[model samples]
Target: MTTSATTETRTAAREEAEGHLRALVGSDDAVLRDDQWSAIEALAVDARRALVVQRTGWGKSAVYFVATLLLRSHGAGPTVIVSPLLALMRNQIAAAERAGIRAVTINSTNIEQWQPINDAINAGEVDVLLVSPERLNNPGFRDEVMPRLAATCGLLVVDEAHCISDWGHDFRPDYRRIRTLLDTLPTGIPVLATTATANARVTDDVAEQLGRDVLVLRGSLDRESLRLGVVRLKTAEMRLAWLADHLAEQPGSGIVYCLTVAATQEVAAYLRDRGHEVAAYSGQTDTTERQALEQALVDGRVKALIATSALGMGFDASLGFVINLGAPQSPVAYYQQVGRAGRGTDDATVVLLPQLEDRDIWAYFASLAFPPEQLVRQTLEVLGDAPGAMSTVALETYVELSRNRLETLLKVLDVDGAVRRVQGGWVATGQPWSYDAERYARVAEARQREQDAMLAYLDSTECRMRFLREQLDDPEAVDCGRCDNCGGLTLSTTVSDAAVAEAGEALSRPGVAIEPRKLWPTALANLGLDLKGKIATGPAAGRAIARLTDLGHGQALRALFRAGAEDGPVPDPLKSALLTVMKDWSRDWDERPVAIVGVESSTRPQLVGDLATGLSRVMQIPIVGRFAIVDPSIEPGRGAANSAQRVAAVQRRYDLMADVPAGPVLLVDDLVVSGWTLTVAGVALREAGASAVLPLTLGTQT
Candidate 1:
């Protein structure tokens, strides 16, 4: 790559890199492919930016690791790798060790190792250092650690580079921080960005962000080793039964991906009950627990790890299959998840069990898209006027965005130079920032197109793998002859009726605990509310008959909650389920409610009132009081949007509460979306001298 290098010099460097690659792969015959060597030369020798977009198993890691060693031998400093997943970091550390490269990672899981790792970086003893993109925004890292590293870094790598583009299926807000990182690195430092799932659009976006003269190397995105198929089922019970009856026949330990955390637990429990060894895993899984479960999958100690997207990206194992319990929201995401399998293997199965509720799940995620321009303007205005930096919680009181959405918005604003994150919290940079409504609308439209593509994948009769490749804009897309439609081997969907019945029982038997709010929301005084800090007395932890996301009862709940549904007494089946839930309540007789009360519902007053009446008649409890609307003009929809807004609406609505409930009370409501309504009502009841309040709701919207 160096114009002045002699032939001997280039050949020697090539040999050295190949030697390292052989050792990393544990095969003496393992040599770098031509494209891999090209990427390596562009970085290690030419000292230029390169973007590598290749299919999984194409040795992208080998390109960077080999380049790191080559650069080190030439007296360069350690390579800083911005990776996206903890599982990937773990796999990378082990892979680096095999290559005799001393790699260390700084992530959420290894907080205790940070000091030593930083020390090693200063000592020049570390060859490669791994970190998450989110870490780049951490005040300590951005202000203290990054400037030093950028000044000394030899090579910088951004793994899963597709995330840097909003067009990508996984366009994480944190990943946008990498653009700032690139701007800070020394001018001549070699930079490499890589991903296996990027389409032409994502590839161009990433390369443009990397800067001018970046060497773009995109190969065919096809995996011949993966045998893709779809198992269509009419109901959740049928799908669960299918998994129970056929999962044991899969070749080896693999992953079972679900869309939500609750579904992960339910499906995992059902499979375990059916005598398969499995574990439930999600982002909520503790750090230690995640490590153990990841190891179990790698070691084949468990048949499968039921998981959400948290377990995805860079988890390396000799996986023989990947089964999606339900379709992902997009084909690109589906390809990324299935890429976890069939690495270095001749054959691996990828199956999708498309659920009837997939579109509904897609709609739920769509609701969390970028907020309206008014909300964004509100957040910016709040930050601009604040005396000092405001924490995300404080911002939530001033703006209607939820915590997660607010945090994500802050990151985007930070990347756009409208705001900056400091040690304590966030401060506006006073830069004129224009809301790019057209850009956001384009992104939203892209996401919808991806969802439609996924739906097409589900119904396609051609090669399933080809459909995925086409979705990714792979020019080599063709029938692979290895899919179910192309005559690939597949499992049967003949589940026993008994298995279906068992799954039905598991799905329908529902009761999720509703943990009571302990402390009131912050900044209550700003809203002219007296509440602050911990409450002395409030509602006991309560229960819901079912979650609206429940696989068995969710469809029915959707029908009941859907706009324009008739409002009347609780349906007989739900009434029966409610009584059964009461019978199965964990509380003792002494903790039972002595009286019944109905919380006024503007949307479905009949549903809430009938619940209270039915409970009183069946249990013979006294009907003491009902909460009435004190301010009917209050916008109740705000109660479901943000904490401060919700508390205001709820407090205003329930100011006129009925008196004379002297004992534990059963407060009935149609649904609990945010719990602010229930919280305000319970606190008011306690202040009015009720002994205790317990909430019973028809559904939880989680």
Candidate 2:
């Protein structure tokens, strides 16, 4: 063919691609930026791996969607996107459909739809498929469906790719499964890794995983719309008061980020009490509720969604403001969350309210890091010598770790080839695996450094944006000339006395209901406990004077209950709080407790006795008697073990000491965790003919 004809054909193709991109964005005037085009060219034309690190609003989604359409036109197979969030998948699917590219997702919430989705993909009817990183570990998906998709995928895209790096603030173990996927991918298939927040270290880690000669496209990280500032509050109450006072003034709908799910609920309740339209979004939120909350934020129906990091990453709202109740431990996490705001506006407010507890929270999270070599080896030995594949639940019976911590360790082991997750459960891979002590130590060190950087950011007099950029290792870290420090703008730090008082009162108004354990824990039979199905007889729903993390009474309770805390009589103030709790409980009581029973404590016998005595005196109920230790040698503190072990331990430790009361009785304890203690005690009491057992405690450790 003539050179002129070939050139004309190529030019026409480019114009058509641009037109498709414009349609995808729903803007006739929409045009790709140079870097966006470069990413597209590298993915569709060059068929090479590429990483796009740009600000949130830089149209990263557009690049991938446009590339999907172009690749589909050339008859490349469906684009396989490993997205981190369900909200993001929904948004991407909607946007892809707008561009006439078919997209579907397979996630935990959409299990019933998986078969049809797989069928559609197999039939070449899907142009793009979005899957969560966790899905890569699913037995059926990994063993059956993923391989077929991987072999023919048009392009592989990792959204929020920073999560793949251990150095990332939001490192997810499931993301490591992507390395297996990458190793098995067909040659000549292009890959795209996109994120708005990855420092130089994370970038290097992710890029190395992508492949040799991967293209790295990083844009300036500055967001002119975000006006960054920090408001250091003296206490949680003051910080909450600040939010309640100033939330209404923020432009458009926004998010209020909290460090914990409990904190999210607390903040949301306080805000609602202060008359703000808000909802709490966190992992604990039901899937349907999460969808509703996401929609509420998008439609601007709510002022804000008080949330944990669960509400982050892939939530696409042109939020006008982002307020953090407590600072994230890492600057990258803070940057990613704040990036959610000001994406579609010229100006947006981003404020951080750093509290003293943020460091404690950070430390708590750090403690959940990769397990020690002993634990890792123990898990491996268990799997290696197992009779067969063991489900994570059953495996936990052999390991004395929380389900969360155990699952995390298992995922890490799965990546390291120490074990394999299959249809039945996990089996030892029989591959030699060495625990990387130095690597884990480095990760811990990196986390501490990030915490240090976050603290520095809170105290820095330099440009706030510049400080963040430097933390992310952005070369273009010049002062943004917009933050409070760079622009000489200081937000009002004063919180009203009335507001603080009200907040203090709200936080201190203790007594969160301790919902009774309705069912016996699963797999008790395996533990030789002879327990099966739900427990027919158990303690009635209970109440705690305060959670160990409560804002008001929580601090005192935590201090009193902390390890090494001296055992003593229940103090006068706590007695008053206990009285107040009962008073509150009386309002909703269906039956007056005729007696009080104390759970015997080996360490805090004095405290437990005092609390029970105090309640007995104030409520004028008979003292039924305290539970006696069946085995005095049995240690008092609950061990970190699975439910079966816990239940077995509780069963062997305590027994009813005296005749049961006929009427409802209040079963008092120093603290409640796992609910096994109360369960066994209540069962024994019921068997001994108590009408009902009402559990009340000074603190709960949920």
Candidate 3:
């Protein structure tokens, strides 16, 4: 074909592509941005790699969707999209169908559908496949499906690609597996990485990982519709009051972001009590329930979904507002979340209720970073010596790390070529692995800097959007002319006294349940403990005065139980609160406890004894002697430790004293953490003639 003829054909193809994009968006006048077209051309015309670092709601999804269609038309295989959240995957599936493309997802929530989905993909029945980043490491998918997909996939897209960079605010270890995927892809296949939250460092890291000679398209990161403001609340109660008072008056239905699951539940319940239609969306929310809640928010059936970061990334609601109960640790994360608002609307309210406790929360999160080299080496040795692949549950028996931290470490090792993720679980590759202590330390320092930056964002008198954009390294950032600082702080910080009182009551009234352990730790025998299988009969489902993470009583309880705090007897206020708990608890008991038994505590003996003594006096129950520690030298250790070590530490350390009173007895302790102490103590009491054991504690740690 002549050059003029080829030019005419290319122009016609672009016009037709634009037509399909317009139809996909349901807008006759829809037009593609220049950068969007550039990304599309790179993926479709040249089959090259591209990274698009644009603001949220900037049609990043459109670029990939449009490219998928163009590639498929040219007889390309299905597009593979590795998304980070189930909510985002669901929205993408819906959007793909609207664009006359078939999209499916294989996620944790849909185990039963995997076989058929796999079959459909093999049969060329799926145009696009949306999967979680963790799916890349799943035994069946990684070993069986991924190899085929990598060979034949026409386009590979990584949404929320910032997660692939450890320097990013919300770094996820599973996303590191994407680099391996990219390595195995054929030379000519197109690859796309998209994120709205990447800074210069994260962008460089992700783009470098994408490949050589990659197209890096970055645009301004300012949100025109977001009106940012910070509401400085003196206490948690005031923050709750502010959200409850102003939620309805906001532009429309949106999210109320909480820092922790406990806070999410508390805020959601408080809003419900205040006659607002709301639901709690958190990591603990069931998959089906999360879907339902997401739909509720999308349909405007609920005014807000009180959520943790769990409700973030791909929870598409053209929300009118995004209210945060506490500031996030990183301005980048704050920008990503607030981007959820004002997507479809011309203007959306974005408010931050900054509390003094948010910094501590950030510290707690930072503490979960990559473990030290000793633990990593220990895990490697354990896996290296194992007879066969051990499941994560079984592997926990041989390691001292928590499940989450251990899993994260294993993923990092897998990416570093020190471990191989196999069908059953994991195996050490025996690779020469050197722990990058300097890199880990540098990442920790970066996180601290981000936390400091977040505090600055909260306190800055300059434009809030400008501050965020600058943090994201957006070069075109300027005064947005919309934020409270750029304009004026128009949001009222005043909260009604009645609302504050109600919030205070909700925060103060605490009866968080301390559910009993029904099963022994999976491999207690390996730990040299005789425990195995079901915990035949353990402490009855118990209640606490409050959770350590509770919004209302949590702060006080957390301070009271903080490390190095002087241990003392239960205070008068807590004693009175325990009485109220007992009274309310009595109303629901089928059989009232006739005796009280104390769990021996070396660290807080006086506190535990006084609490048991006070409960016995108020309930008119006799003291059924304390369970004494059999080995004073064996420390029970911190409650925050893993289940295996925790259970093993206290398994045989307690023995019920002789001549204990009979009948149902209340087991009193200063706190219930892993519940192993209660379990072992209850077993001793049962053997010593108590007919039943009822547990009561001052507080419960989640």
CA lDDT of each prediction against the hidden true structure: 0.87, 0.85, 0.86
Q: Taking the tens digit of each residue's C-alpha lDDT, what string does model 1 give over 1-702?
A: 353667787788899999988888889898888999989988988888999999988889999999999999899999999999988999999999988999999887778998999999999999999999989998888888999999999999999999999899888888988887888888779999999989889988999999967999988888988999989888899999999998888879999999988889889989999999999999999988999999999999999999999998888888999999899999999999999899868999988999877888899899899888898888989989999998887787778878888888899999999999997799999999998999999999999998988998888888888888888888889889999889986658788999999999998886777779888888878788888999778888888987777777777787799768988889988888888889888354466678877888788988888898898999898777777787888855665667877887787777635664678888778888998778878877877877888888989888
Spell out the clash pairs found in candidate 1.
none
Tens-digit lDDT track for model 3 on 539-638? 7788888887788777777777887878888877677777777778878777888888788888888888888777777777788588889877777663
As a TM-score, model 2 comes out at 0.95
The TM-score, computed over Cα atoms with residue i paired to residue i, of candidate 3 is 0.97
Kindly provide the TM-score of model 1 when superposed on the true structure, using C-alpha atoms: 0.98
Candidate 3 lDDT (Cα, whole model)?
0.86
Candidate with maximal lDDT: 1
Q: 1 or 2, which is superior by TM-score?
A: 1
**Candidate 2 on 281-377: residue-level lDDT in tens?**
9999998889899998989999999998898898888899999988898888899999989988998999998876676667767778887888788
- Candidate order by TM-score, highest to lowest? 1, 3, 2
Candidate 3: segments with Cα more than 4 A from true spot:
1-10, 638-640
CA deviation > 4 Å runs, candidate 1: 1-3, 586-589
RMSD of each: 1.5, 2.5, 2.1
Question: Per-residue lDDT for 254 in model 1?
Answer: 94
